[model samples]
Target chain A: MAGGGAAASALSTPWRSLLQRALDGNAHLKHSTFFQLATVGGGGRPANRTVVFRGFQEQSDKIQINTDARSNKIGEIRNCSFGEICWYFTDTWEQFRISGFIDVVDGSNPEPVKLQLRERAWFGSSVKSRLQYLGPCPGLPIPDDDLIKDAHLDPSAGPVDAFCLLVLDPEKFSYRNANAIPWMLSWPSILVCYVNVKAGGAGLLEINYGQAMNAAFKRWLVEVNRKTGPPPQVANGRLHIA
Target chain B: MAGGGAAASALSTPWRSLLQRALDGNAHLKHSTFFQLATVGGGGRPANRTVVFRGFQEQSDKIQINTDARSNKIGEIRNCSFGEICWYFTDTWEQFRISGFIDVVDGSNPEPVKLQLRERAWFGSSVKSRLQYLGPCPGLPIPDDDLIKDAHLDPSAGPVDAFCLLVLDPEKFSYRNANAIPWMLSWPSILVCYVNVKAGGAGLLEINYGQAMNAAFKRWLVEVNRKTGPPPQVANGRLHIA
Candidate 1:
């Protein structure tokens, strides 16, 4: 584990716990690991594709995703780092929409911890998966003889130049207030934090329970907010149910 | 069916057959109907979510997708009509990336044919699915009592104000040349065409089969292009395998 994501680690744990709960609940389904990732493409149009979630980076809230350096997404991220991940847990009937800036950690990155993370990601991948990167550039036409080149590949070698790791540092999490509150109400939810890591990780935890709730529920939200500590920061969009 | 999309009906049939084959092959899986739609949001950032495909509009290539008028996606589409759909067929191991401009047809749309399409989409939806629009505004805080309002709703009524039908008029279809060519090889593939409907349906069908494929494949592409009976117009990016 690297400390590069220490700033993002300050994000409140309740949302992480909710996500973990969903992951645990849907552990039986292999499809649970896949999520849709959206990126701003050329001409500022939107491009989206399904991607496998590797996991959270180290212990931070930042999401880790593996992509080929030669892929269109790599170019898309280079042009614009803004991205969003929409993950739906079928068993829990919960959808997490995380919008953030992605930090591309490739061979060009200077940070030692990031390089280590990249190495770890490389070593963690199966040999079959790693060999795909050694083939011709993705999305391009394949050469006449690709099979002959595979025999010379070394499985134990470090990640090739094409292996790139994307760390999405979440800036905001929006909850469809109605859908989120029902699940959190069971936990007597109060805290609604918007972790703005882009602000140098000064976590802005806002406890906003709208006036729509009943008097008793409002009182509980206030009571829980007082007990949670740290004053509310600048307001952002949407209620992030904890 | 309404004939508003008659102009786009000029798209060649081979590509349609390929997509049809994938759909027919994966008809057993319910998840096969769901695809990822990406739209350019505010600040030109990409926003993506899983959307159910309602199939092509009548006999044309235009994709029909039902959405709520109150949804952020509706607003995003209004801001910039450029959108892209990436659909992966698990059974066939095929991915289709179609980029186009979306036409939003709500109560405000004056076109009679478009209105008929909307009505058809509304009537096609399940009663339970249609009832959701009758509820509180989505993404907003729900009031204390919502269940009481559901009993008085008329399920058979015409589409509510929130219900909207989106017609994506595809301009370009991209293929990961390597992945697409292998599958299309079985069909003795030829003719990669880009249909540009944005030119008021002048239908710029560009036959651009790249030189990356072998000589036999190149000859096949030329023969197919000649048989298709139209001159290639306007160069575009990425191969569109047929």
Candidate 2:
């Protein structure tokens, strides 16, 4: 709530709501050309990777991504919770940078929050008919019809033990326009969001925006949350989303 | 050198020359959409970034790129010398991954390498002008002379101060095709380059039909080096490309 006073003042604007809507209602959100995640490694130097965003949390200021637990990224997050997420919106000529903490969740965990993730896994398996490999590899040998049928005998096969959820709890957020005027370019009007990490805790802070813009953004955030439901929880250092 | 033994036994084909030409003659070498550099950072976590290849050194296995010295990537190289460069050829559905070590050079230093970097910087700045900024204030006074100029001017400005040479002493290289196989769905054979960084700076150990398909790609890498020249060195941890 440190920046709440400033945020409250900006929340009086309608433009904020429009900006928020533009972010959530935009169909091309999933088509970001380059998405980067920066995390502190155990050796303490910052590490980051480009990943596809699976979904967004408008109300909670959260973002969701899917990854294999066996990947190096998971190990980095496990070592350090503080990290940054950057999404380049080429269509809009803008860059959205979010810095926050992350928690990993498993698909088979008993937590109710994980139900949606399990469903997504099932859907993913059905659509692809095989788990995608991360890097280049030799072709998979074709299985006989019976072998193929046998593999699909159980829907659980869809949930590879490697699949996991990565939930980002944003603490600071900024949207930068790279095409802005040269002189006025260094710092554009940015909106920053800070989150309280305690269980069931929520706080919103807006940074450097006019009243109309903040209000518009808040409305959009609320709407996005309503659509996505509550923020998922971290059990055993993993996020479980319903 | 360890992987070189296996490479020699792979195959020898007339297509080797084709692959070599593709690497050395492409005009669009630097502008490829998917160019990535992977370097080891603190704690040994690998870091990768998309970069525009400025040049390559077939003789030394050195690849040069213009970068900001102040960027966090500088810290990454300071911690580890080994790195990997990966290029994704979307048109061909092929990927080339090169692993090597890097060496930073100073542009302002009295070395031939530094002089070459300065020449490139001069060439870049000659055709361009500095970009001026407009006020951030909405109704602030506007300057009549403030206008956008050519982009090439000082393209090396930030990069010179931030840039350093990334000499990839190749330890190993791999070419993989990520496409459906002929007849049945299978992956094409992989062409692995197990280079002895010190023994064969740049020479063909073996080649076959699979590598012939990558002719255009090899030419692209060499083209990058031809155009970019060399990386400026680091003097007291700073680049003097200007």
Candidate 3:
């Protein structure tokens, strides 16, 4: 297991732990988080849309979002194979900007890992959500409100073909205070990390402190694994919590 | 002015008018409005950030957003020359996805029109907003909370060199019902339009209706001016209301 995000001498509680706790769960996580999925479209013009955050896997160093297979974003993801998701839990006064190259899992990739992920994602889906793909392509014209409301599918038949898991393998994480002062003033956050994608490899970490916007912390290629407490050492095979 | 987007027969009220009313002044515009500024970085990865809706120009088919000169977004816009802004005002239950190319005006462009727009934007900016540029480059590390809180400029000195006007020249508009149901179902909104950049020129318009997601309204090269009203025809030059 790669292990490098050490606690800085400045703050009593490490910022990584603060982030981990936020990701672990809270009361207001659902409302505040927005997934930023930007794709390079024609003429290299980027198309960005906000989607609901389905899940985040700290162990795999991946963030998860769901999308309809028929949606424009799926095409964009396939074309670019990279994107970013910005999450702000204003309740916690913290924001995270994650840039990751995407690794998708859908009905096509029927491996055990994919199956486990899809099954887990399916368990979380509501009948209303499962029916999102039953209608025509998104960003297209619809007949009327009544027609749109009536465009539901039979749930007994199980999830449709459009259900997809977009797991973002994060390479960089930018943590910042979501207040009017420091954030607006461009004062850097206390912590930032650049994770190397290589399995069991080290990552770059930077921490800042002191009074006058000083450069207090910067580290290169620290050993980093999935978690802080006793690395699970899942290097041999991938496993997840059900 | 090209006037092809005549009020459609399907809906009792046209979608354009509905949108115009919402933008005219409503309690709900602030939360849902986010400008989608996409710029292709050196690696071709597009950078996207949400900016406040400074204002919207119905007469000249332009939308307004303010940004700092030192911010990364301004650099991206100058590189791309075009971007998109997605606005979802849930209170009115209307979502607008506007596609526009870019035209920026700062103190550098001292034309009367530019000066007027800049002055109007300046009036809307708060002291806190004006102070955003005094800090270091955004997305950079900061030393501490005190450093951030102390990083404000003297109010009497006024706005800094970082303040710039971002006027988006709109080419397309997609307005949809903001209810989670149909919008998630990818059902198209009631009104969509394509505005030609040329003044007093015809633009394409498309409206949808019927029971089965039908395309009932389509107008090619219809006269399209800023307002969907009887043409005052400002074809010779770009004119806007104060």
Candidate models: Cα lDDT each:
0.61, 0.42, 0.49
Put down candidate 3 lDDT per residue, A1-242, tens digits, no spaces: 01112211122223344455455444343444444466666677766666666655434455667776766677777778877555544344445556668877777885987767875776566765665555555433332324445455555554456677888875655555433212111123333233221233322222232123333222111111212221232223321111
Which digits, one per residue and each the tens of the lDDT, describe model 1 over residues A69-93?
Answer: 8787999998998898877665454
Lowest summed lDDT over 10 consecutive residues: which window, candidate 3 chain B?
Answer: B1-10
TM-score of each model's chain B: 0.68, 0.49, 0.57
Better of 2 and 3 by DockQ: 3
Which candidate leads the pack in DockQ? 1
Write one digit per residue (lDDT tens) for candidate 2, span A161-196: 556777776655544443331111011344332222
Q: How does chain A of every candidate compare to the true chain A by TM-score?
A: 0.68, 0.53, 0.59
> Model 1 residue B235 lDDT?
27
DockQ of each: 0.30, 0.06, 0.20
List TM-score per model, in order.
Answer: 0.69, 0.49, 0.61
Q: Write the per-residue lDDT of candidate 3 for residues B1-242, one digit (tens) a residue.
A: 01112211122233344445455434433444444455555477766555666655434556677876666577677788777665544344345656668777777776977867776676566665665555554433332324445455565563456668888875655555424212111124323243321333322222232123333222111211212332232223322112
Return whichever of 1 and 3 wins on TM-score: 1
Instruction: Show where candidate 2 strays beyond 4 Å.
Output: A1-50, A57-59, A79-99, A107-126, A129-150, A153-158, A171-178, A182-242, B1-50, B79-102, B106-111, B121-126, B129-242
Assess candidate 2 and give its TM-score to the true structure.
0.49
Q: For model 1, what share of native contacts is present?
A: 0.55
Cα deviation of A128, candidate 3, in Å: 2.6
